[model samples]
Target: MEILVCVKRVPDNEESEIEVNADGSDIQRDDLVCSTNEWDNYAVEEAIELVDEHGGNVTVVTVGDDESEEVLRRGMAMGANNGLLLMDDAFECSDGKGIATILKAAVEKGNYDLIMTGAQSDTGAGQVGGMLAAMLDYPYASLVNSVEVIDDKKLKVGREIEGGNQEMNEIDLPCVLSIQTGINEPRYVTIRGIRKVSSVEIPIQVASDLDISGDSVGAASARVKKIDYFVPELGAGAEMLEGATEEIVEKLIEMLKAKGGLK
Candidate 1:
């Protein structure tokens, strides 16, 4: 199938206390423990499974700095055939479209029949896959939960819509899909597996190699800028519930009755 799955490395939210940086433009990441994006795990798994049954290869790619190579290696450890690293100082602080432009250039460098991305990253923008599809002028789908190969040229895809309804459609090959989590159980990658692929060559592409001019990308070219990144303050009269599930449930019940929400 020649599938290309886009993955990302992000701070493990569960392992750290995330706070807006002093600049307010990003989070404090200096001490953060980073790992592959959770949703992307499902995307990588789905792509590998598809290629496994269809007799083809899966390539995992990401746009990040040198440290980002670990996620690529992790994907390879999960059965992807190859890894791609798109690294460049010019790509720093790029907006959704700017990031998409870089990804579009990388996509052009391959002969992939399908491109997949996580529905959303930690940033929660969820804009890369759709924007990349638009830039490539290819058919696109988002929140895809299921995909079935009908033939070499076609696929039956199921997506989750509002109200939690599932809509199915047939999309042509050479299209893009934003994979939703829970689509599959991502395989566990042992430390040994990662060490095995540590020697595999992963090509790194830069702005010059992709023909992307300096001014057209990076912070200066970014149309959308993050002015602030802070967690919302709790509203008035809000009480926090703490403890085990059973304790929380009892507290909720007491609060609801006291508030006249239940009799």
Candidate 2:
């Protein structure tokens, strides 16, 4: 089986404050620390493990500027066979749909038996995998926590559902799976592996190379647009209730009733 894993380089939200740029088109990224999307790391690890078990190759792909290569190299260090960087000035300002379109174009250029991606990006726009699957007209499952290869052309997957339930199903090969976090612990990239992949050239693909018009990507092709961005004003602080447990409960009920929150 040949697996293709799509990864993204995203800002480390935990370590940086997100401020909208003056243009209102995107966030201010100049001071942000960028790293591979956390969930994508799990996808990469799962792909590598699958290949390790089934005897196949795993390729990692990403779409972004030069910095995006770092995420691909990280994947290679974690045992991916090769990396593909879809870099083009035309790809800037692309929305999720535009990205999925480009990824579909890239996937078409390869012979992949399985495709995996994070259930959602750091941006929380969980759209890429499903959109890419739709574009490719392939079977897809989202929020997948486990994947079992049933045969050369079939796979049984466990999808995470509400209330911690898992829905298992069998799907044919050449399908896309949106992996969820906690599926597996991602391995760290060692210094030696990093140096090794650094010398391995990563091929770049432009929009035209994928048979896509430059104008048909980026903001021009985006299905959604950001109208505004601003930090939400901090709301009122919580009020602490002081009394016995029963008294506190009674006071809470009274407050709720006064606010018309209860019968």
Candidate 3:
């Protein structure tokens, strides 16, 4: 059971404010603190648990610049066997499909039985896992909250659906699963574990190394383009309508008639 878990570095914006950059297409990230994507931590923990139970190696992968290595190291501290960093300037402007292209190339290079990723990123794109699965032509499931390995080549998974429903299915191995949060509690990275893995060298893979064309990734290959980006303005304050129900209704009707809202 060689599991490949894909993680990402995201801004810790829950405790901080977000500011749009000058280009109006991205966030102002210079002063922001970065950490593992919250959902990806659950994915990492699930992978680690699977490996611990089945006796296998867990390799955590991330695609980003130099700063991305921090998340990989954190995964190692959480008990991943190794780490792979997919870094290149060409990846900077990649849209969902472009990213999937690069990831598929790298995943094909490895002998992995199962691939896992977060159900959605903090950026809220939520498209990579499905795109990657399509690119790999692998069986795919999203919003997965539970996994049970049936055999060396099969698995039974439980997915969360709307209305608090759980959909259960059995799928073949060599598949991709987008893990949702609450599947497992992620273990904290201890200082000792971090120190131990500090000296472990993480291999960086570039687009060329993965045999991915420069034109196949980045902004040029992107299927979607950001025309503009801006935060929504705060709307007008609420108005209070206090009195008895009949009086309130009468006042509302009068106001609506006065405003030409009613015939």
- C-alpha lDDT of all candidate models, in order: 0.93, 0.92, 0.92
lDDT of 3 by residue, 10-127 (tens): 8888866889998887888778988899989999999999999998999999989998999999999999999999999888889989988888988999999999999998769899
- Model 2 ranges off by over 4 Å: 22-25, 234-263
Best by lDDT: 1
lDDT of 2 by residue, 155-204 (tens): 99999999979899999988999999999989888888888898899999
Candidate 3 error regions (>4 Å): 235-263
Which should have the higher TM-score, number 1 or number 3? 1
Clash totals, every prediction: 0, 0, 0
Where does model 1 exceed 4 Å of error? 242-250
lDDT (Cα, 0-100) at 130 in candidate 2: 98
Model 3: lDDT of residue 200? 93
